[model samples]
Target chain A: VSLNLAFEEAPLRGSISFISQSGTLGNYLMLLARAKGYSFRAFVSSGNQAVLEATDFLEYFGQDEGTKAIILYLEGLQDASRFAKVVRNIVPQKPILIYKAGRFDVGVRAALSHTASIAGNDRIFDSFCQQVGLIRCYDPLHTFDMAVALTTQPLPKGKRVAIISGGGGYCVTMAEAACAWGLEVPTLDYATAQKIKEILHPFAPFPLNPVDAASDVRPMTYARVIDILMGLDYIDGVFMMIPFMFEFQLRSAAAIRELVDATEIICGLPAKYGKPILGNMIPRVSVGPALDLFQKAGIPFFATQDESARAMSGLVRYAQIISLAKEVPFSAEKPRFPRADQPIAYVSRVDPVNIPERD
Target chain B: VSLNLAFEEAPLRGSISFISQSGTLGNYLMLLARAKGYSFRAFVSSGNQAVLEATDFLEYFGQDEGTKAIILYLEGLQDASRFAKVVRNIVPQKPILIYKAGRFDVGVRAALSHTASIAGNDRIFDSFCQQVGLIRCYDPLHTFDMAVALTTQPLPKGKRVAIISGGGGYCVTMAEAACAWGLEVPTLDYATAQKIKEILHPFAPFPLNPVDAASDVRPMTYARVIDILMGLDYIDGVFMMIPFMFEFQLRSAAAIRELVDATEIICGLPAKYGKPILGNMIPRVSVGPALDLFQKAGIPFFATQDESARAMSGLVRYAQIISLAKEVPFSAEKPRFPRADQPIAYVSRVDPVNIPERD
Candidate 1:
């Protein structure tokens, strides 16, 4: 239906999948997701859903190994009870993010005209999503922001996140948000602080909870800090800032080699320590070739402190969601809408190459 | 002291000014700001605050014709009371946005090492900002997110905002945010809505608070919808989404003219109506030449729904701040510190070509 949409993008396979009511809105989400270095496993535009609705597709992808995270650009659920039933079973093993439109009376009216979907009482819908263990996103971009961490990184075991920074400003910014998001920013132990001080420049700030290197930053400072933080028993993840643009002037062969070496260590830590590492810049920049190195190494850089911290919290909260799900018995059910004899569109087999394996 | 910083930037004169304790951090902010189509009026790296401190620069730019919005990347106050006195006078006339660091004990310890300034209580700083009518930013990029609207757009009279969208999903996303931020998303009256409906694509959704044009959107549709929304009796501002990419495939000169004409109407709204018009995308992107036309016309587009709402709320809140200031008696204070004998670095007169005068 949206073949006439502006972009005709070649599929770049990854672990995220989206099911949207409006095909145009789905295309907008896809464009931005690709900009953030995420690629969809499949996208289903559930037009009118006269036969196969959103949840039917949701149930199919719920067990699909390729779809680690599912995003819904939703107006209204086709079968509310059926959705709640299916999601309760799937969320135990997978993540489902919903960007529910028509939350207010004004938007509800808009949704009615755009599609013939009934946007029920919003507060009821919200609590229902919570009850079913589905993550509700406030905006379209927000769906991508929270979904990225779940798809790419290893889940943090607990709420203890170590924040490391090249600039002290980011430490304050990320710490404020991390605290607000119910994640702990614990102080570094004396032994770990001493170890970091030995590697830092003489004029640099002393290591603390944020692990502020300040003026001591280099291309490799990030790798060293991550190594020490990830080694700590109490830390569950590292949500940190990198100043790759600080080393952006070094176009020489040796400088380029130094950056690649540092990226290898930084990217390797999440799998090494069984924790997530969310990288960011203080002022939230997306330009520079230096960023490409980390992205290529599979370390997706979040643009803002709020985003990176919120992404980290998404991982921590999902840990609880998954843990809670283990107690509930899974109800296996047959699809209500009979499948078409034709195969589903564009959904392929699982590609393990995209997902990072935890040791 | 830090002339070795990577890129040498040519001065792109504009209304925003920044004063930071850390030079590196300020540069990162500038890089991202430029990427968002902003240029600096003056940047002062307050190194160690030996003779001229951050407040000294603040007091200077507070009076400078060029600096419409003042951004402070602060660690700690060298002289808190005098700083308070100076800012209270300046903030009523021009916004002084502060992104304060050293909030918690962890960040405080880092700040002590990074700069030789005494860190204070976090709650006190936040409350003090609220009491004195100064806006306290949570993050560094947040400073620009709030500051851009102040420098570029007119102050909204009230909290009422009309959201217009090419995509129904954005109507939901933006309306959700605007309401959360305390801005009213009031439905359009029968007459006004009918007028909007008359111009909309016949199959499109009815215009309400969000004014969902949906599939009815066209290059000229934005100009017509914005024209009605801006001219409304109740609307204080319009925060809308544009999909120039919908018409992106039309490579002919005719399609380009259509987009360019819409840009002129959208950008000219604030000055025309004495209210602000903030443009955005559904998934929050920053690409396309269609944007270049809007940027050249002095309209700044915020990237996220949260950011656009927050920016709108910043303007509404500042209007209250200005009103509060007007009620209080003005006590003029003299600068406690002496001025530099030589001229201040790069502080020049503002070019009025940048700001859109509110009639």
Candidate 2:
């Protein structure tokens, strides 16, 4: 099937291209990309990748002028060295994001069942991604969200992050995952703690990083909390955790709207200044209406804590890659395409008209 | 979108009725049912199931002339007692199979995220289902498969099970799951073991009931193992865990076809001789084309070990329900409907003709 993308921009227009192996998955990605309206340069489905190897695409993506980053859904690889070399070249110019399937035992079996794919050493690849400055993502949704963060936000000067939650449990979950992801939970200054304490009750302790402003918090409380968190010199990013627990009553909706609006405004303030805001919208089931408001105001929202960490890390990685791109020189000689004489197997087997019919 | 289903006869023809909550899941079930050519009395969808409760539909299905069994997807309950009472009444006359969502913690959250359904006390419902003879199934695919088994094959006389595998690992996995599911693994008699030795190498000690004939087995070896296992007086069912590892080669399709054909012939022969077979398709991902062959021969195929146990248990539960149906007397009670005068919001909210188009 023909692949649909958010942007028809040329490959060289910037740096990121996402390649998916499954047509159904590719279509789903396209739908989400359009919904998110991420300015991705290109989206392609390398079905089978029998002729146009993963290395060839990586090489082409590395040199593309418009390409800034690259994302991939790997089924299996043909040449590991070529893949490594291309990543080595691209990491100096642009960041590459990857979500490699068959990472888990169940996933490997699932892949094997689907296409008899040989699931190679996934752990080795994860380490390899880190070595090459490639930002690894967990799922398709997280991939797009990370792209937004990476493209928009600056590299955090430090790992110190502030977490604000609408509920106590969500903030706790976010703090735990963030800690696991290597983000620092630094203590806030006494002045900032006192500011938070003025709004919060005496029973609830005003924690340094993860500030749980209880469920009965109003819109102004959210704004004040954001101000206090952002004011901390050690905090590089803010993670806002909101749940979908409230009903769709008018008063509740109004309060939610105010909270979301204040959060968005604070996020913009951080953008206006030099900090980053990573909004972790936990209890991601019915929080859609509330999230739409924040999203419209240019705050990238994440469903899970792990995804939020991925997005934040991606943003930092991309900023580093952009800086690296400014220093690295292009190759004097263009890399030759291996198997150039080989017939395009993907084309010969594909009927563009018939492909869409499957969708 | 219109719902599609295949029915051998109308609702008045005395057959089963299956219903679902989600349209997408419902459509998949319909596809599977149609593919198998199931003669369902009727199929219905209670979209959102807000006003007209599951109990209301169950009562309607109970008194309906053609319905012999009822299948459902229980995401949320409107009236648990009413639903339980309907099933309790139908237990002695008509069988009911339920696949309830929200049993697990994550499942409950996922259900709410997907359909805005508040998953209530799942433990209470689980005990209630067992009390009322409602057959509970785990995997959706297995649920549909068990429906076929219950309708086609006679109930197993006992839980004594024999496993035939191409490898030791898969055999062990099957043995563990079957034994855990209350099926006995009977030791093969010396004569039966010798019969198997004639087909394969005699030196390799048979792995007891599993009869792992090793990797160098031919189609004849598999058939011989099945023959020996089925010949045992204590073995009530057969679990075939075939891994299509050798089927990677282009010419291997023929070999797979031969093995599948042989397995089918042996399995059908057991029923012919008044014994039932519960075939557990091991390591779901490797089944490939063999699934189609097994289904065509009325052999149950499961993708996972848990699912395999679930399907067998469902069939056993259905047998108990069938026996109970024969023992208890059912009165021709008058069917009841929800009070029509009750105010129902959102019923006419979206007028199909003039509703705003969604992107």
When summed lDDT is taken over every stretch of 10 residues in candidate 1 chain B, the lowest stretch is B344-353
> What is candidate 2's CA lDDT for residue B186?
75
lDDT per residue, candidate 1, B33-82, as tens digits?
77666677777778567888988888988888878998998888989888
Which sections of candidate 1 miss by over 4 Å?
A: A1-7, A217-222, A243-261, A281-293, A328-359, B1-7, B102-105, B243-263, B282-293, B331-359
Q: How accurate locally is residue A355 in candidate 1, as Cα lDDT from 0 to 100? A: 17
Worst 10 residues of 2 chain A by lDDT: A349-358
Tens-digit lDDT track of model 2 for B128-233: 5544667765434445655655654556666677766654434444554554454556777788766777776654444456566555446656666676677677
Report each candidate's C-alpha RMSD, comma-separated, in the order given. 11.7, 18.0
lDDT of 1: 0.71
lDDT of 1 by residue, A167-219 (tens): 66667667766765557778878998899888877767777778777655367
Q: What does the i-RMS of model 2 come to?
A: 24.6
CA lDDT, every prediction? 0.71, 0.56
> Model 2's CAPRI class?
incorrect
User: Each candidate's DockQ score against the native complex?
Assistant: 0.16, 0.03
The candidate 2 chain B region of ten consecutive residues with least summed lDDT is B348-357
